[model samples]
Structures are given as C-alpha cells and as structure tokens.
Target: MVARVGLLLRALPLLLWGRLDAQPAERGGQELRKEAEAFLEKYGYLNEQVPKAPTSTRFSDAIRAFQWASHLPVSGVLDRATLRQMTRPRCGVTDTNSYAAWAERISDLFARHRNKMRRKKRFAKQGNKWYKQHLSYRLVNWPERLPEPAVRGAVRAAFQLWSNVSALEFWEAPATGPADIRLTFFQGDHNDGLGNAFDGPGGALAHAFLPRRGEAHFDKDERWSLSRRRGRNLFVVLAHEIGHTLGLTHSPAPRALMAPYYKRLGRDALLSWDDVLAVQSLYGKPLGGSVAVQLPGKLFTDFEAWDSHSPQGRRPETQGPKYCHSSFDAITVGSHFWEVAADGNVSEPRPLQERWVGLPPNIEAAAVSLEDGDFYFFKGGRCWRFRGPKAVWGLPQLCRAGGLPRHPDAALFFSPLRRLILFKGARYYVLARGGLQVEPYYPRSLQDWGGIPEEVSGALPRPDGSIIFFRDDRYWRLDQAKLGATTSGRWATELPWMGCWHANSGSALF
Candidate 1:
C-alpha cells in the first residue's frame, strides 16, 4: 500500500512534468492509480471500500495518512526516502485475513472441544539436564548465499543475550570439529536422519535440537537479515532457537521468545520475563558478572591446529606456556580475555581484573618468564609480575626498570636464548633475565632480524620451534634459528587453523 501510494505520487508528478517520455498519460495514469488502490485495499488501508477509480484528492489523502502513520512527512508526495523505506525486506509473519480468521476458528474449535475433553493436553516441557553452566558453541558452516559478517554478528548478539541472564558462559570453538553446540544453515532436505525438511522461503525459518542434542539449524531459503528490515531478523530467530538448545520448549505466552511464531524484538526486548524465568529455572541465577561481548574487530581462535601440528600435542594442554596458563591459553585483546583450553574449550570473556587481580585493565603486552615461572604484564610504561596466579610484591614498576620501552605492542619470552623480547612500532627490544633490571643497550630495530612486522599485537613460541608474531588479522612465522639473523619470514600458514578463518565472520559465545 505504501509503495503504491508513493509510486502514484511520483508518477503523477512525472506525467504532469512531461518526464515520462512518449507514454500515454491516460493509460499510464489509470494503471498507476489502479495499482495504488489495489495495494491499499490488499493491505487493509481500505476497509469495505471496493477498488474504484480514485480522484487526485482521495489518492493524495490516502498517501498522506500512510506517510503520517509511517513517521514520514505529512506531504502526500512520494519522496525518495519514503519510497526507499517502503521496499526494504520484512519478516515472514503473515497478517492476512485468512490466517487471522483461521487462527480464530482454531481457537474456537479448541475452546468448544475443551468441555468434552477427557484429559487436558499437556504442554511440552524440557528436562533438568541443563548445560555445564559454562558452555561453548561454534558456527560450523555458513549458508551458501548469505552475508557472512552480518550472520556472525547477529549470532553473537543473540547468544550474548542469553548469557546475560544465566550462569551460562558461551565461547566460539572450531567449526571443523565437535563443540557443545554446533550452528549451521541448510537448505531444503538437510539430511539429519529426521523427516523434517526445511520448506523454502516462507515456512520454518529455523529450528534447534534440545539441550544435550547440541545443534542449531537455519533454513537457508529464508532471507535472513540482521536488522528489522524485509528479511527475517537472525538475532531474534536465533535467540528463540537457542532457547530450545538451552532446554526450552514452545512457550504458551505469545510474547515469549520461545513462542511458536517469530516476532521482531528490539535490543531491550530481546528476552522476555518468561524466557528469563524458564532459563533460570534450569541453570540457576546468573553469576552477576559483567557481560563482556566481543564486537566486530577482535578475532576468534582455538588450539585445534596447534594440538594437531606439534610433537608436544597433549603437552601444551597440561603445561603453562609463555602466553597462557598450564591448561588454557588466554587471547587477550584490549582488556577482554577468553581462556581457550588445548582441547578447544573456551571460558566466557571477562575483564582483566576478573582473571588477574591487582593488574590494571587494558594491558599492552604480557609474557610468562620460563626462568622464574612467573608472568610479566606490561601496560603503558609500567610492568607487573605475577608468580603463578598471584601478583608479586612491590610491583607495577616503571618499564625502564626492566629496560623496556613505554607502550610496547607485543612481548614474549625466548627461552632458548634466555631473553625476554618485546616488540613495539618498527623496533624490537631484548632484555636478559635479570632480577632488578634488564641489561642496558637492548632496544633494536626490526631490520636487525630479517624482515619482520614493524609492530605486533602478540607473539608465542610454537611447539614446532617457530615463533609466531601476530599483527592485526594476520600473523608471521619465523624459525627459531632466525631470531637475531636476517631471513625472510613467511605468513602463518595455520591462519585458518588458528581460528582466524573469515575476516569478518565470527561470534564469541560469551
């Protein structure tokens, strides 16, 4: 209706202005006006009024009413902005008279039959075996024809909403292997051994297996979208499906997310009281921690590749490394850190303080010393040392005390040469193991060690004896022998394996 009104308004002006070339005004005007009237009647803009030849006054008034209701200007003319707004994608929820009438008839039927019912039909409910409080999920695959980044972001926001109200901790894992919850999109007839098959665009937007089943599937046929536009909102639908994955059934309340029908929800209305209570009943109350969600910029990774490539495959799983604790590795970007186990399990991300007490937030660089079995955290011009999980006494001293530069970009311990290396913009610094301070005359340029990244975000010694330096989305690999020698370095071959798969496609569960 809105489109037709806008089209007629624009077309009349064009016809009056002689802009529509060579076209007969009589035929064109009548056709356009008829289309406008039919659109209005179809969309319920006209109640019982039959489609008729409309005059300029009535048509323009109808357009004005539509514009006013749509929060547009009172002008009845179809402006470019209003025309564009009318054509965007939308949800599959149908408001046709037949559907409404059918629903009413069904309700009446059920109500009439209730008096003769022998036993009340029981509602489908979930069992008690909630997930392990802290759980992980991964996007096993993307739909063949959808925008990857939008889908990933929508999924992240959806999962984050659930984690906000429950004890659940969600993190991204490898899509190649097994995860607690595996997410994917499929077209018609996705063979899951179940007879249920996705019916193209209009029916069955998505579905999920119940808890412990650990599967979420979307119908690729639907035009899935991130925002409230023409297509189905992925966040809204996924949040509903994830409710099922977390042990929720179809809710009796129409407004609940777990309700059978899909409804558009704003960020504030993402979860309802029924949803919160249902999930909480299974998982207990949330731990009352900060909801740390990773936005677009930061990447997601796992240890699956490292475990497969290294001789110390399982050893890294049990022993502490320079960038991580014994059983888990920490991917610290900005102030948020997620603990990734060697087996690819991940904990919910938290502030630096939540993981390391007394350490200031937004740490610039960090490295665990192999000599003293302590971790050194660097931020700004100061550095703090941690013995195991406890901060050392009399700490957060100036980096100059350790012969380090202010605002170091990355740091790592080169155990073989027994030196702590730090990399900043276009330069590198090496400090020998000294109790009170680093040996003098250490900061050097990157040119000294073959061609390496001028600046890096983080670095770690791989079990294969190669050092990996991370800079933005990519990482460089350098052999151990080339630490101080001139040698051309290669890009990290395990980029995909390290969970840096898609440039903009990712979702951190927690």
Candidate 2:
C-alpha cells in the first residue's frame, strides 16, 4: 500500500501534499501497530496485495504466524517480546508460509523418520536442482571485517558440510570461468528491486534464489564474522544460503540448520540430523555408497591457492566505509565513545581500528561495565563511559586507584562472577562495580589462571562462558568458573575459534 501510495502521489502532482502532511501520525500503540503491519508485510506474514486493509482478525492471525516462526509465544497480540524479536538480525528470505510451513516441517520430520529413502519434494515452479553432481562457486566479494583467507576458508568449509553427507560436490570456480553458484555482497539497492534490495542493516541478513538461478546475495551492511561467537557468523550464513542455492527452502524444524533464524556455531557437526536427511533425500548418498560421514571437524586448511592479501590491500582511501569520505575532528568532550547509529541521519560508527588512518580511532583500554551496561574506554590514563548516543555525566574520570597494576596486559569480561578481570604482569585483579583500591587477598597471581603466560595480548569468552587467553600463537582455554586450564595448544590449528579448518570437501576429484 505504501508503495502504491507513493506511485499515486508521483502521478498526480496537482494533488495537495499539505493535506497529507497536516495530520500528525499517532504515537505509542498506533505506531507499534503500524510498524507491526509493515513488518508482517515485509516478511510475507500477510498479503502485500493492494486490497483493503486486512481485517483485524486476519492481521491478528498474521502476528501469530510471525510469532510462531520467530520462536516466540503464539499470542496474537503485538506484545513487547514479539516486537523485540522482530528487530533481531535474521535471514532475509520471505517467510511465505510462516506457520503452515513450520507445521509441515514437523510432519516432514516424522515422515522422514519413518522412511529415510522417501522421495524429496521440490519447492519451486522452475528447476529446483542441478542435474550435474559437481558444482563450482566463486565469491564476487567479501566483508572487510574478516580476512579474505578466513572467509574463503569458511566458504570451503560450508560447502564441505553439505558434500560430507550427500552426493553433491562443490569446488571454487576459476577466476575466468562461469560457476554454478555465485555469491556476492552488496551495500544497498544494487538493482535487486525495492523488496529485494539490501536494507542498510538489521533487516534481512541475506537473500538467495533457487538452484537453477545459481546465485546468493549477502548484505555487506551486516557485521559479518568468522568462527568468533560475535555478530553473524559468515560461515553459518554461507552454509544456509548454499542450502537455498541447492533448492532447499527454509525449514522451520527447530533443530534444522535451515531454520529462519541463526544459532551459535557449536563444536558438533555444523549440519543437523534433519539437514543431512533433507539434502540426502534430494541428491542421494555419495558414490562410494558408504555411510554418511559427519564428523566434529576443523576449518579447511588448503588455503594456499586462496588470495591472502586483498586487492585493495589496506590502501588509505579504502579504509573507511565508501559513503563516509574525508575526515572530521570527531569532537565529543565527555569521556564517551560513539557506537551504532540506527537512523540514517548520521553515519554509523566503525569499530575503532588503527587502520582507519588520519583519525584517532584506536582505544587504549576498553571494557563493558556490567553494573550500568555502559562501555568504558581509556586512553592515556583518561577514561570515558558511553551510555547511549552521548557520553552523559562529566566522565573523563581519572583512572581510579582500583588496586591493579599500571598498564595491564589484557582485559576481558569474566562471566563467572559477572565482573571485569584485568591481567598485569604476574598478577590479576578482579574489579566489581565500584570496588576498593584492592580487594582482600586480591591482585591474585597469574598462576591461578592456569598455564597462560604473563603478558597475554587478549582474551575471548566461548559460547559456554569459558575464557580463552592468547599471546602470539599459543592459547589456554580455561573454565574460569572452576579449575585451571582445561585445554592448551597451538591456536592456529587446534582452536576452532581461530577459524582454521581441517575439513576435506567430499567432492570427487575433477
């Protein structure tokens, strides 16, 4: 309706625009209601035809369908949880049959359980699959956040996940030739139509076409990540989109990889049991006729052929986002740092990297304070805390004498006690919300943190809330809630979080 209204206004220029602007839009519930309607329309929960508005009963039913698809309570009301879930980052594919499709998935699960060799169903009016067993894919581009090698490694691994269980095989397409599947990234509105255009961010992570079309598109606006448990894992998204390119539609089976939502990549097989069954039903088992091989695997390591350095290679002009050109003083007097900007009125803040060039973007010390849920940044003994858009309160506070050594080696949020931990030299300090200069028997020796040597560069928390500390190439994984290092090894190959994979694609040699 909004699109049609715009077309009408453009066609009838003589009509007065003042009358349309004269009435103020309602707020609170009315605003929520409009947003909900648009949300449902955008994702195919409701009909988008230019008919009279859906009756209240039909609209309520649409809300219930969205709730069911989004794994929320099936209450038809526009409750707070439903609204919040709608805002979460998710696959851009339309949920054309949100509720009924999920119900089919439940039935599909049971039917597949009863007969594993049942013929597969196709979802499209056009060709839903490839006739050839071998397929080649090429990356048109990649996100800047992760290294090219890492991204290709993730791609290879994602492709291998499918080939491991089915007859389908994939190989990287040569630079000069055509490929069966082409994956590309775009910022916004790259001629894919308004409905399919990549919305700046937060809506529709990526969209894909059926098998014969042989293409997948990701929103470059997304904070695409690798094996790290932050942002949207590109490997996971690539795996799911590959499913679409192979003619697999969205599966609402809660445990299936093709679910509309994302999940944290775990230590187990990336493909779920249902995912294996679905692909096998379509393409059948490998030529060897051996049992399906699903293993707890590593990221592929045959990256010697992949481009290591980007074509731009960190050039000064290409450092920042393309739209944000030139530079500014970036003035903010209070001890606060800028973050995400949802509204397009202002440019969104980039993650502080020394490579941004010509600007003071790097941070000396950074920590998320658990107490007030604000981010704290420290530079040259000066500190700033950001609450929201502004750095409220006169924060540029002096480094409090919080009983820790000067120039700590590393800082990470310790999930065990819900506090921040700082490592300096051979001692560690645990600081609570406004603690004393030092706590009793505190500034504990680094020895308590297992075999992690002093002067660790940084630390990251695992999905299970365990801490993995690293310096140079080595890492020590610790269950901080209990004992010392549970595992320690060379990080590049051993640690899954490093994005290194030992996976071998099941594709037969070409």
Estimate TM-scores for all models: 0.35, 0.54
Give the alpha-carbon lDDT of every model.
0.57, 0.63
> Which ranges of candidate 1 are over 4 A from the true structure?
1-128, 192-195, 288-510
* Tens-digit lDDT track of model 1 for 1-510: 999999999888767645433343345666655665554443333432234646665667665654543446778764444444344332222112322322343465568852342221111232424548877888866666555554565567668778878788788777666678878888778885443466767655777776777888888777765444335666677777787678665543445566556655421244666566556656756786644332221122222222223243333322222123111112475456766454344455577776678886556678877778888887667888888778785656776766677777788888676878877878878776643365666666788656566656777776677777765434567777865422333222233334222224432111
Q: For model 1, where is the 10-residue window of minimal lDDT?
A: 296-305
Give residue 148's error in model 1 in angstroms.
2.1
Error of 2 at 450 (Å): 15
TM-score of candidate 2 on Cα atoms, chains taken together: 0.54
Score residue 359 of candidate 2 by CA lDDT.
Answer: 20
Candidate number with greatest TM-score: 2
Q: RMSD per prediction, one decimal?
A: 17.3, 19.6
Strongest candidate by lDDT: 2
